[model samples]
Structure formats: structure tokens, C-alpha cells
Target: MISFELLLGVAIVAGFVGAMSGMGGGIILIPALTLVGIDIKHAIAVSILSIIATSSGSASAYARDHITNLKVGMFLEMFTIIGALVGASITIASSTRPLYIAFGAVLLGSWAALLFAGHASWHASTQDGFTRWLELEGSYPDQALGETISYKARRAYYGAPAMFGAGLIAGLLGIGAGAVKVLIHDLIMGLPPKVSTTTSNLIIGVTALAGTSAYLAAGLIDPGLAAPVVLGVVLGAFLGTRLLVKLTNKAVRRFFLVVLLVLAVEMIIRGLRG
Candidate 1:
């Protein structure tokens, strides 16, 4: 059995990274748990739970600091919840290897796209009629830039469906799919990187909740293992939120790119080896 202290320590690191990059802690925690000899299904269940904790810990801080775009978060959440339910049900009866590889490929593509963009920041120069009607726009005080950054979200038609796909991956892999969500927010919706990360943080909790019910119904959640993870991630997430607000958008984008590249390669390798 993995020691409680060890799990707690890993969860803390996972949470910190998750919050920093807007990819829920599950992306880190699931792999660690599996490598430590825990069953993957159980690890996934616990990871999903920790995602909730991660969001709870950091989302409020982002929202309070006015970094989160609440209108955008709430709007995109509806599709993700539905996708999460369907994806969770599929995971119970399917092989995960293909899913892992496929998800990694998607991340790889996203990484390449972002890299090729070459530091061109996402600024919403125009909003479509639908986006404007929804009022999917906001401004936040940026500590790193020493000024307020305002942005409007566009391309809701593309972003909503893409979030469904993100939710599906989250439910299938217990990853919260925050990385994909962030990509969609930036690439499709034209939101700033900081806004994308913070808004992704706010949206992930609701998506996880939809998936958690499926796992709970299957009796996959082990409270004993989940306890320490939840506690540790919450603590780490709080720390991450404090630091993220102080960083520049470019710094956050760089961090996200690095993490996406590393995790995507690792997951693909694991899937191929299996």
C-alpha cells in the first residue's frame, strides 16, 4: 500500500501544478497513484475527487481576484457536464489505452499549435453576435503587467462543442481536461492566457462533479485513499492561486506549454508500452 505521507506529498505537488496550469491535479495524481501500485480505476476515482478539491481551493481565489470570467465559465459548463456523463459511462466498459494515446495526440497537436503561434497573445479584437449577446467579456488587474487586461470571448459556436470533447476526455481519464479547456479558451474563444487558466479552473469543478457520480455509482471511490489526496491538493491549490496571480500571461503560457508537452509524451509512452 502506498503510504499516506507519500500520497499526500504527491497530491500537494499535483495540486500546485494543476492550479498553476489550469489542468486539474488528476493529470498528475492519477499517474503517481498507478505507479505506486494502486489500481487504475480506483486511482481515477480518487483523482476525480481531488479535482473537485483543487477547483474548490483555487477557483474562489481566482474569482475573488476577478481573474475568472464567470459568464464564460458558466456558459461552457453545460456542454461539459453532458459530455462528462457520457464519457464516464464509456470508461466503465472500454479499454483505456486507446483513449490515453488519443488524448495525448490531441495535446501534442495543441502544443504544436501554441508553439507555432510564437508568443502572439490571444486578444479578443472582435466578438461575434452570439458572443456579444452572451456578454462573454471581462477585465482583470494583472499584477505582472501592472495594468488591467480586458478581453472579449469569441467563437462560441466552436468553443462550446470543443468543451464537450474536453469534458469527455476528463470523464474518461479522470484528468479534468483543464489543459484542453484552456486551449479552447485561448485558441477558439480568443481569451487571454491568464483568463483562460483562471476560467478553466472555475469550470473544472462542475465538470468533475458530473463525472464523479458515475464513478461513485460504480463503487470505485475509496474514501480512505481519497482523504489525504483531497486535503493535500486543496492546500497546494491555495498556494498555486496566490502565485499565479503574480505571474505574467507569457509566464503562465510557457508553464502550460511545458507541462502539456511533458504529460502528453509520458501518457503516450505509457499507453504504447502497455
Candidate 2:
């Protein structure tokens, strides 16, 4: 087994990578924790801690740049928050190994969706019905080029369902929820990549808060592991934010897919092996 200091070192590296990729620290940290003798349940609890740290640490920059679409985030967050609460309350568990198989499938789906999902562009907001009621349309500045990229939500009703689904997955898996949130923002909400990524970052903290309570109530939390992971995630997020744009788009997508696949496989093997 690796020493605690060594585990922290691994966490630091994972934190930097996850943050740079905008994948929240949990995505990377949970998998690493599994290798270090931490159970999946405990890993998830720690993941929640790490997510909060990275999100809080990074929210300011995204907000200051105006790349965070507060309107869309809050609107969709309503459903996500509700979903998280439900996930916390009623997630079925039967050896999460099979769950890992499902997770891998979803990760692959997320990867494929990103490959086909085009960059978000502008659209007119719907003037009628639930669209206006949700106030889902909005815009944000370009974090990369300092350009203001304004966009409107494409399908309000459809997007809400997607957000709700994303929230449920987040509640069950303890992921940052950005994987689905970013996709919805880009494809459904018509926000640019920078805006979607930043806004997702802003909203996940809110989502994690709702989910963490449930995870804790289920007796899944471990502060010893969570502390180091959160610390590592915060440090990594700083570095990742600095390099978010430096990596090529194709590279980012490909890397994200590969990483997801590995984690999925890891979870599957662990589930089956145990």
C-alpha cells in the first residue's frame, strides 16, 4: 500500500489534471482513492469534499470574467438540486461494480456526445410557454479571447429533462455533474464551450452540497481521505484553470474519453472482483 504522503502526492497530480480538464477533482480523485484501499463509498464522500473545494476556489474567476451564465445555471440547478436530493434519498445499491459498468457506458456516451456536439452558437430565446417561465436563456463572456459570446437556450423543456437526468447521475455517482451539465449548456442551452464549462463549475458546488448530505447520512464519508483529496483538488484546479485553453480541443476530448474509459473499467473490475 502507498503511504499517506504518497497518496497525497497522487491526489495533487490528479487534482491538477482534473481541474485543467474542468472535470472537477472528484472525477480523478475517487479512482485514485480506490487504489489506496479506500472503499468506493468512502471515495465518493471524499469526492464531494474535493468537488466543493475546487468549485469554490475556481468560481470567482469564472464569475469575474462573466463567462458563467448565472441565469441558466440557477434555472437548471433547481432541477439538479432536487435530483441530487432524490439520489441521496433513494439510490439503489447492489455492488456498484455493475454500476461501474453502467458508469463506463455513460462515460463513453458523454465522450461520444462531446465529439459530435458542436460548439455552442447564438439562438433566439423562445417568447412563449415554459421557456420564459424558467428564464433559461442567457449569455456570457469568452474566457479565452475576452469576447462576449451571447446565446439562448435552444429547447427549454428538453434541457430541463437533461439537467434532471444529469442531477440524478451526479447524485448516484458522485461525479461533478459537469459532464452532463456542460453538454446540456452547449447543445441544449446554446452556450459556448468556455461559458458552459465555467458555468458548470459554478453550479456544481451547489449540486455537490445537496448530494453530500445524503452521502454522509449513508455513512460513506471519511475525513482523513477527504482532507488530502480536497487539498489536492484545490491545488490542481488552480493549475488546470491556467492551462484549460493551452491544450488542443481534440486532445482534450480524446484525453477525457480515455480517462473516462479507464475509470469505468477500473470500477467494473473492482465491482466484479469484490
Candidate 3:
């Protein structure tokens, strides 16, 4: 059994990394908690709570910066919600070993995004019919460049299904799966990196809300476990956002890859042991 203080400390670090990378705290929280002998499902549920806290805490700043695409997020939420509900139900019914393997698989799949991170440019010159109809294009001021960066969101048809898949992963693993969400936005939909990341932070809270509800009903959420984690995440994520402006994108991406490597190994080991 892990001490409450240790759990809180772990969550704080997880939240900080999550805020920096837009991966949410769950990727770190779940593997760390599980390695410490918390039940996998319980760890996942608790991690989901932290995801909610981190996302909600960071959302205001992102929104105020006009980086989040509210219209696009709202439109995609319809698919995510449905996928979340189904995924949550599946998690509740599934066995522990399978969950472990599934978690590892998800983590492994996430590595693909990292490979493309430094090379991809998301500035789009063309908008699709869905993008035009939905008005999912927008711009934000880039303080670093001292100019406004405008971009169009194309390929909404593909992005929606990708969001549904992201939501499924979130609900099943008790994670925000924000990496996948950001990939859909930046890679598939051609949203700016800043916009995709901030929008992902905004979307994670609501997606976790859907998953948390199912966990709550399934008696998987222990309030004692969730409270410290949420508190830690909220505080850490707040501080992380404060530091974000000072860091370069390269710094964040490197940190993200290091964290992902560590957690992926942990997850795979746990799955195989089971």
C-alpha cells in the first residue's frame, strides 16, 4: 500500500508533465499507482479524476488565450461522448489482465505521434466541405512570434472518428488520451499545434466526465484515493501552465518522450507479468 503523501507527490509530478505535454496526468498516474500495488482499475479511476482536475484547472487560461477551438470541440464532443459511454461499459465488464495489455497497447500506439512531432507543419491552405460548413477554422496570437497565426481545420470527416477512438481509449483506461486527441487535431484535421494542444486540454475534462460517471456507477472510484490525486493535479497543473510560456516546444516534446518511454515499459511489464 502506498502512503497518501507519496501518492500526492506522484500525482503532482504527473500533473506537471501532463500540463506540459497535453497528455494528461493519467499516463503517468496509472502506471505509477499500479506499480505501487494499487488495483489497476482503481488506479485508472483515480487517474481519471486527476485528468478532470488538470484539464479544468488549465482550461481557463487556454481559453482566454483564444487558442482553444470551442466550436470544433463542441462538434466533436457528440462522438466522444457516445464512444466514452461504450468504452466505460466495456472496462467495467473486462478482466484485469486484458486491461493491462490494452493499456500497454494504447501507450505503444501513442509513440507514433512523437515520431512526427518535430517534422509536421499543420498550416493548412485548403478546407474541406465539412470544415466550411462547421466553420471549424480560426486563429490565435502567437506571443513568441509577435504575430497572429491563422489556420483552417480540414478533414473533419476523419477527425470525428479519430476523436471517437480517443474517447474510447480515455473511457476504457481512465485516461484523457490527450495525445491522441492532439494528433487528430494537428495531424488529421490540420489545426495549429498550439490550437490542437490547448483544444485537447479543453476537451479532456468533458471526456473524463463521461468516463468518471461510469466508474462512479461501477463503484470503481474510491473518494479517498481520488481526493489527493485531484488536489495534487490541480496544483501542479496550475504551476505547469505558469511555466509553459518560458519553455520551448522542443523541451516539452523531449520531456514527453522520456515520460512515455518510462511508462510504456512499466505498462508492458505489468501486462506480461499478469
Best by TM-score: 3
User: Considering only N, C-alpha and C atoms within 3 Å, which residue pairs clash in candidate 1?
Assistant: none
lDDT tens readout by residue for model 3, 79-164: 88778888889989998888888888777666556746464765566998878899998889999999999888899999999899
lDDT of 1: 0.81
Q: What overall lDDT goes with each candidate model?
A: 0.81, 0.71, 0.81
Could you tell which candidate, 1 or 3, scores higher by TM-score?
A: 3
TM-score of each predicted structure versus truth: 0.81, 0.84, 0.89
**Model 3: residues with Cα > 4 Å off, grouped in runs:** 245-259
Q: How well is each residue in 203-257 modelled by candidate 2, as lDDT tens digits?
A: 8888888888888877777676666677776776677777765335777767777
Worst 10 residues of 2 by lDDT: 119-128
Would you list the rank order by TM-score, best first? 3, 2, 1
Residue 223 CA error for candidate 2 (Å)? 1.5
Comparing 2 with 3 on lDDT, the higher-scoring candidate is: 3
Model 1 worst lDDT run, 10 consecutive residues: 115-124
